[model samples]
Target: MFEVNRVTARSSSLDAAHWQRRLDVLAENHGVAGAVLGILHGDDMMSAAFGVTNMRTGAPVQTDTVFQIGSITKVYSATAALRLVADGVLDLDKPISTWLPTLRLADDAAHRVTLRHLLTHTSGIAGDVFTDTGRGDDCLERYVDGLASVPQLLPPGTGFSYCNSGFSLVGRVIEQVTGKVWDRAMHDLLFAPLGLDTTMTLPEEALLHSAAMGHEHQADGTLQPAARWGLPRSNGPAGGIVCTARDVLAFSRFHLNDGRVPDGNTLLPRALVRDMRSTQIELPFYDGDNNALGLAWFRQTWDGQSLIGHDGYTVGQNAFLRLLPSHQLAVVLLANGGPAPDLYRALYSEIFAELAGVAMPSPLHPPQGSSGFDTGHHVGTYLGYNHEHEVLDDDGVPSLRWAATGSLVDVMPTTEGEYEAIAAGGDLLLYREPGQRRWRPATFVQLPDGRSGLYIGLRAYIRAS
Candidate 1:
């Protein structure tokens, strides 16, 4: 069990030795190739890096090492859009068509999409159908232009679905209003003003010297370097920015400090920043714990305290950032190897539990004398409230699989009754029902009370003959 280390309310720093030990253990035990972490409290901060930036060359990671920040880029993009709102060039309630005439969804109702809808991911726009080749700027625009081919899954502001398409549209809005490309606008509005020198939309010739080569675990349980590619110019607004731990920490702190620069320059109005952090949509697609959407950030409650941030995954990189508004605490974690499918969320939750003086939940463990049953029982066809599962044989051994969602998970029993579903592609959770005839599948569900709950919260499943 993870224990919470008592910290004083006035304490500005965590135990450096404790953080170092946790970082080392995460790297060694979690198959993480490289990790960059930053912790902020009040006016003081601590940042550290562990593991190799490049596994093949065995080069050590430095505090300044840059990693692709994945969807965390959305926060910056959303901030840029809100800044325009502050400047009176954009309106939160006005339709996006006010800025870009070409932007449209299948339904004519989609024309009602406002900057608020785009920022909170309620535009009802579908995400990109093609992978971001990271090749050029036209990629995202072409993707947006092709949206007429796909159907709208939900109506605008009716329900919450994480639409990457909404953010890409935000990028286009930036272009239309500022007369500058999304990348350049971001550089001017956010990065340059804050001195985040390591943040960039594309890998520059200079970054080649220190760029950490991303990697993935191979079939034989060996680490292999993954190829690096440029994110298309179009998708730059959604998930294209790359930066070091220190820079990300600075960005996160800006939100924690109410959208001001380190020296107290008011880059964003406090009211607007508060609006960005306020819950605009109750995201139904994500695990309904405290997961919510506020402007562009995922808002949640941890140990009774509110945290605002987002997690990102692309190519072979995974990143996470969390900011506690009440305490002015921020944490940023970046990893090269994608392990623990839920690595980012779990790490942040554990860290926050410790920081907030709560005991961390026990890790899940597989049933004893049932090693063979672990994969076999969870392998067959199973249906749940929001998703379906079809376990299949990968190499003669059963593995839990989801086709419609494109998730492939390997189950590992931790210690308690919980089982950890590790997907190289991502992470999720599985819990056995205590009294059912077989294992019950857990998925996202919307409660009738207008609240959200997980399947595990309803009842426990137990195996019966």
Candidate 2:
């Protein structure tokens, strides 16, 4: 159990000393270069920073230091789209082609996708198309124009897939309706109105802050700066927003407070806010009590309580946000590579347990006393974005062989059809159904158009015939 010590200047309910000590221990153990953690309980907010902002410069991370928030940008984009819905500028149920007719997909069914499908990630379009459409203002325009070459993974509205390109299209919709560039509209609609000082989309805007550079951990245990600062500007709406942990907590508070901004102005209607956080689609084969997709938010049930949150990754940085509406609490974690996953798991578990009375769900292990099951039915090749999965029978035991962009992982099964991905350092990455009751392994999904594909990581990979 975590104990509260003397109150700090920033929080009334938490012991800053206690969290600082734990963070220190976790960062040291994980070789983390830099991190920021922030928490909000009602009107009270507390935050702590650990490690260095840059490995070479050794600059200490300040509480307000900014890091790339990545796909959390999707939530901002989704909020912007819903605002358009409220203003009668756009209809959620209307076909996206009604607004951007120039956009094209390889499948006719996919071409009929609606705004709702894009927001919920059911558009079925190949989601990982991160081509650099240049830094010009017309970048997203070119991005959508180039979609003629992108294939449809499934017919639109059939299944959920994590679609980065879909969010980029949403950004284009914002541009079409608002007559402002996506990032400019984002600032005017979200950042400026929400009083978020550091949240921004461009490298030039980010240069104004004491920004943290991403650090990649090498095989020899050395850390180096990332070769690229970020993806192209056109990827902004998908996964390109940069902000501090404190600002992320503020954004979480806005959602918790029924869409009201800091100045008591309603940025969006209360009902739309509720709908955004409500379950929009059911995730297949998820292990949690009730895991589903809620607009841009991912929903999970823990200890009979509902948790809504989103996580983002960009280059060498990872960001996590978790909100407990019932408790009126939210937590944000930002890290620049080097064992970030391990630290986040440990820190969030302790914080949520102590503050919200919700236990961090246990890591998934193979079912107790497994009976031998037929492996023949599950053997085949599964595909993902720029990757392939090959299931093989290794001496009567099932195994998963994955190859992706010059990387490979071959692991024997710990149970039927699921394998324990062991890292070189002997870490167990259990990639089975609902590992941690949050994410599930890939499974076969059939489209309404009579096509089949593997649905994993919230995106479909059309199986090669």
What lDDT would candidate 1 get against the real structure?
A: 0.64
TM-scores of the candidates are 0.76, 0.88
lDDT of 2 by residue, 1-465 (tens): 112122233655667767777877787777788888888888888887787777777777777789999888899899988988999999988888888876677776434899999989888887877777889999999988877777777678887778888999999989998999998999888889899988999989888888888887554657787767877787899899999888998899999998999889899999999999999998764533237988898898877788888888887788988899999999999988776766878898899899888998774444434334334554577666555666566664555666553111111111123444221111111254212223234455565566555555555666567
Q: TM-score of predicted model 1?
A: 0.76
Worst 10 residues of 1 by lDDT: 406-415
Prediction RMSDs, each to the true structure: 8.7, 5.6
Best by lDDT: 2
Off by over 4 Å in 2: 1-9, 109-111, 287-290, 371-373, 405-453
The most accurate candidate by TM-score is 2
Off by over 4 Å in 1: 1-14, 131-134, 205-209, 285-289, 338-350, 358-400, 404-465
